[model samples]
Target: MLTPVLIVLGSYFIGGVPVAYLTGWLLRGVDIRRYGSGNVGASNVWQSISRAAVVPVGLAEIGQGLLGIVIAKAVDQGLAVQVLAGLAALAGHNWSPFLRLTGGRGVGHAIGFLLILSWPGLGAFVGLSLLGVALRAIPQFVGLGIAVAPLAALAKGQSLEIVAGSAGMAALIIAKRLLGNRLALPPGADPRRVLLNRLLYDRDTHEREAWVRRGQDE
Candidate 1:
């Protein structure tokens, strides 16, 4: 019991390392959130810092998720305990205490957790992701693909723990897509338009360039 609890707590802290923040500060001497869609994730790192920064930030975050799963597995805990550790890691990445409860969208972290549990889950993820790209790269559908991985896990007879953990990651991704960084609309900007852009375009309709943060092909 104590071991599981410690795993959860330790994983949470590991998940909250603020990789993007440090990466940006070290490379450009600026708060990543201040520019490039104001996101504290790999996407923003690519925008404000360098194209190369994205991979490292993503790897660090994914490693955080994997760290939690490894700890759980090391304790020889059952599926339930392992799932809890994974979720704790995701929550920490999504709402990192070090980043004032602001963090990445959890896409990489989700990938890490699912990949560790079941590679087939990633097959669902990739197939859907490629389909979305083939259809002209619609942001909404691409993001919706996240939900498919968990369902695939469930259909494949994975344990409840695996299914729930995948589902949790899907939820975090969808939620992030819907409600991105703190709402800082320019005066007179229609909330409805902003919501549409966030949900569909993955950027502020008004300030697409800043949101793209050098990541998009713009």
Candidate 2:
């Protein structure tokens, strides 16, 4: 019991490493949270920093999720604990304690977790998400991918625990998208519309260029 507890705790801390935040600080001497959609994630790294930086930062985020499950599996803690470890990693990445409960949207982390839990599910998510991106509707496709992940797991004949974990991943991603960085609404911005936009577009406004450049203008 103690070992499982420690594994989950360790996984959380691993996921909470804030790779993008560290990357931004090391490469540009800026707080990533203040730039590029104000997200401490790889996409922000790409937008706020050099495109080259995105590779390492993105891999690290995915590794955080992958490492958690790997550790659990190494201990032979059974599927339940493995699933818990994965979810704990996602939770940590989504609401990292090191960032004062602020963190990324968990796309990379989810990819890693799903890759280990069910590669087929991951394929479904990535395929749909990329399709949406190709169509210039990232948020919609991302949501669709997340929504379809558990069904993909079910179709692949994954265990109930794996299916639940996939659903749990979706929940965490959706929650982060809805809550965002907890930034205040723009003056005169309707609360309903802002939240709706956040849910659908992952931004407070539809202007992607403007939103990504907001930090630079600040």
Candidate 3:
């Protein structure tokens, strides 16, 4: 029991490392959150700093995720324990202890977890996302594909642990997207409408090109 607990906690700390924020500071001397999407994430790293910065930041987040599951699998002998560890690592990115309990959106971290836990789920996500893109849906709908993959796994009758973990991850990622970066509504916009915009267009209602202006994009 103690060993598993330690593994989960350790993975959380590992996931809490703010690679994107630190990377932006190191390379551009500005807080990554202060520019572009005001997000301490790899995407903002690419938009605000040189595109090359995303490589290391992406590697760091993904590697941390893989490291967490690898440690779990090494310490345990069952899929359940490994799944728990993967969720812990993912939660670390969603609510990182290192950054005052705030963290990135967790897609990159999810990539890492999915790689270690279920490649098929990852493939499902990619395949569905590509299909959505081909349908001319917005980019944010592609994000919905993450949820679709796990639900598809459940439909396929995969093991309980794997299916639950995948679905839980999908829920967390979409929840963050729904929350956007703001805690309060920006007066005049309906809450439901704003959330819908975020879920689809990833911007406020009809505010195209807001991303380029910085501070306006979620």
lDDT of 3 by residue, 1-218 (tens): 44877877888888878888788778767766656655567767877776887888888888877786797777665787777777777788877787776667777788887888777788887787778778866455568767776876777777888898898888877776777555455568898898887677655454755553564343
Overall lDDT per candidate, in order of appearance: 0.77, 0.88, 0.74
**Residue 28 error for model 2, in Å?**
1.1
TM-score of 2: 0.96
TM-score of each: 0.88, 0.96, 0.86
Tens digit of per-residue lDDT, candidate 2, span 1-218: 44889988888888988999999889889999888788889989988877998988889899998887998888788898888888888889889989999999888889899989898789999999889978989878988898899999999899999999999999999989889988877779988888888888888887789888877876
At residue 133, what lDDT does model 3 achieve?
Answer: 77
Tens digit of per-residue lDDT, candidate 1, span 26-106: 987877777777677786787677888889888888888788888788879777777777778877877889988887777
Lowest lDDT block of 10, candidate 2 = 1-10
**Can you give the lDDT of residue 84 in candidate 1?**
76
Q: Which ten-residue region of model 3 has the weakest summed lDDT?
A: 209-218
Q: Which candidate, 1 or 3, has the higher lDDT? A: 1
Q: Clash number for every model? A: 1, 0, 0
Q: List the residue pairs that clash in candidate 1.
A: 47-213
